[model samples]
Target: MSQAKDQEMSMPSSRQESDRTAAPSNTKSLTLNSTRSGVGTGNFGGYGMTNGAEKPSVLHMIMEALGLRNQAQNREPTSKDIGTLIMLGVMFLLFVISVTGFFVMWFTEYYNNTMLENLILAENSDTAKSWLNPDPKYDTLLKAHIFDYPNIDDYLAGRADKIKVVDIGPLTYQEHTVKDEVSFNKNFTVSFRDRKSYKFLPEKSSIGEDYVVRVPNVPLISAAGPVKRMKPLERLFVSPWIKQFQEPLFKELTVSEYLWGYEDKIIKLKSLGRGRRRFGLLMSRNGTSVDSVQLNTGEDDITKFSIITQFNGMPQLDYWEGDECNRIDGSEPSMFSPHLLQDRSTVNVFLQVLCRKVPLHFEKESSLQKSSEPVLLSEHGTVLAQRSDQRHQVLRGCAHFSLVPALLHWRSGAVQRL
Candidate 1:
C-alpha cells in the first residue's frame, strides 16, 4: 500500500509536467493559425506558391471562362459558340441589307420626282404643241375672230373697222330657244377741251332693246395714254366641284377705296321672251358747255343721265349681287325667264360697264395696282330700253361695248373700277 501510494505521487508529477508542455504547444499552434489568417492563403499553401508567386490576372480568368486558357488549345467548337458566331454574322448582314434598301428607295423616289417635274414643265410651255389639237397650226384658224383683240385701245381706235358688226341670231342655250324679249340701247359721245382733258356724255341709253348709238371720237385725247384693259375670262368662274370644297385656285384680295367714274346699270331679271326687239336711236348733244372743275354739262345738256325701269314698283335690279355664271340653271334654259308658274318668283341680275383691271389668270399674275403693274381691261356697260308693264313681269337685260377718253370723263361715279 505504501509503494502504490508513492507511484500515484510520481504519476501526478509527470502529468503536471506534460500538461505544462502541451499548453505551450497548443499556444504556439493558435498563434500560427492567427498569423496565417491575416497573411492570406499564400502562407497556407492554397492555390499558389507561398513565398513569391504572382496571383492569376483578369486575362487568365476570362480565358478560363471561355475555355481558352491555353494558346492553340485543340478542341472542337461547342454548339453554343457556333450559334453565337452565326447570330452575329446574320445581324451584320441584316444591318447591311437595311442600309442598302433605304438608299435604293430614296434614289428611286428622287428620280421619279425629277421626271415628274420635267413632264409638267413641258406640258405648261406655250411653245409646246397642244395635246388635243396636235398640230399647232390648227389652233390659229379656230381662234380667228374680229373681236378677238389684244387690248381695248386697239379695238376702239378704228382697228376693228374691218369687222363689221353682224346679227348672229338670237342667243340660244340648250334646246330651249331664249323665249324672252331683250332690248339694249346706248349712245355715248366724247368732246375734248385740251389734248389732255375730255368729257363723256351719254345721249340716251336704256336697259331693254337693241339701240345703236355711236361713240363719238375725240381726236385730242384718243391718241394719248394707255387705256385700261381686261384679262382673259377663262378662269373667272371656277368649277363647282372646286368651289364646293372652298378651295381657292387664286389668291384672295381686298382693296379699300377703289375709285370709278362710269355709270352702272343693274337689272333683276324675272323672265325671258322668244323674240328680241332691236332698234337704233341716234341722238346728239347739240350744244354741250362742259365745266372741267364741276364736271357738269350746264343747263343746255341734252344727255340722258340715267335710265330706270320698274316692274312691281321696284327697280328692275334694285339690289345687285355679283354676276355668277354658274348660278344660272343649266338644266333648263327657261329658268332664266321670270314666267315660272310659281307665284312671286323672281331672279336677280346685274349689268354694268366699268373701267377696271380684270383677273387674267387664277394665280396673281402681277401686283394688285394698275398704275404700279400691268393689268387687263374690259369694256363694260349695261343699258336697255324695254317696256315691261306690271302685266308682264319679265325683265330683259343686255350689254353693249364702246370706248371714251380717260381725261374727258372724270366724274366721281362715272368710271367704275374693281
Candidate 2:
C-alpha cells in the first residue's frame, strides 16, 4: 500500500488536473517534493483539498480505521532529520564491513598459517637469534639431591646391619645454554653445538656446597671390582697402585668437591693426558659442548620440527648396540607441534646427556590457570605422564640408559621437557 502510494505521489508533471481528478482517491496523482524522512509535501494521505474538492473513498476509510489517516501538512526537512538519515546509513555500512571481515577470518587459513610461518627458523630472523643465543632468564634449571651415609663409621665397624643414608641436599642451579657454531643447512635443518654453564643459587638450596658429608668411595670400589676380575699376577700389579692412594671404603668430602670436582690419584692416572687432576660426576660437563647436534627447523614439514636428525654427524647412534635401540631420534626439549598432542600421543624426547630418547606418554588432560587464557596440560597446572612402568633400559656395548619419568609443558609457541 505504501509502495503504491509513493508511486502515485511521484506522478509525471505532464498529467493535468482533470486526469488527477479522474484517478482514484487512494492513487490520486500528486507531486512528491519531500524526502522520505521528512513530512509529505503535496496531498498527504490523499486528504488535501482546495475549497473541499476532494471526496471520501475506501483508501480514506482503511487509513482512518488503521489510525494512519492524519491532517495534511507540509514542512521542509529539519537539520536534525537529515543528520539522523546520514548517521543510519553510516552505521549500516560499518555493520556490513564488520560481518564480512569476521567471516573471512573464520573461513580462511590466513591467521593460523601466518603465525606458523613467523615461527619458522630463518638465519636473520628473531627466532634464529633466540635459539642461537638463548636468554639466561629462561626457566631451564637443574635441581640435584645427594644422599649421605651419616653413620658411616658405625656401619663400617659392623655396629649397624645396613648402611642408612640420609638425604642431604636439594642443590639448585640455573642452567644457561648457548648454541655455538649455529648453521642453517640447505636441507631445511640446523646444526649446532651446545655450550652449557650452571650458576648455583644459594637461596634455592637447603644446604651450602661447603657442608661436609660422608659418602661411598666410588674410586676405590670401581678399581677393586676390575682388579678382582683380573688374574693373580695382574691383580698384584693393579693392587699396588690401589693401595698407594688407599682411599677408605667410605670417605668424608665437602658437597662441592663430591659434586663438581675432587682430587683422585686413580682418575688422574687414567686420564693419560695432561688433564685436570680433579674428577667429579659432572665436572667435564660444565661450559662444554660434548657433542654436535642437527635438527629439523620445521621449514618443510612441521611434524619434524626440532627432531634430532643427527648427533655428531650420524643419523643413528653408534654408542648403542642394536639398530632400533641406537636410533638417534626424538624432538628437542622446547619444540613440539600442538597437533601432536591432539589424540594424547606419546611424545619422545632426546636427552643429549642420556645419549637416548625417553618416551612421555599422555596421562590426562589439564589446564594452566592464568589471567590471559588457560593453557591445557596433563594435570594440576603440570603435564606429568604418570606411569606404573616408566623406567627401562636397553643394553648397548656395556652402556645402558635408565630412562626416568619426564614432564612436558607448553607456552605461547614452544614446548618444554622437564
Off-target runs (Cα >4 Å) in candidate 2 are 1-108, 231-233, 364-418
Whole-model lDDT, model 1: 0.30
262-354, model 1: which lDDT tens digit per residue? Answer: 111110010122222211111111122121110111112212111122222232332223332212111111112212212322223322221
Can you give the lDDT of residue 149 in candidate 2?
74
C-alpha displacement of 187 in model 1, angstroms?
57
Best candidate, TM-score-wise? 2
Q: What is the lDDT of residue 64 in candidate 1?
A: 51
TM-scores of all predicted structures: 0.18, 0.65
What total of clashing residue pairs does each candidate reach? Answer: 35, 1
Instruction: Give the per-residue lDDT of model 2 (tens digit) for 99-217.
Output: 99899987666876876776667677787788777777664778878878777577457675555567866998888888888889999999988878888999999999899988766
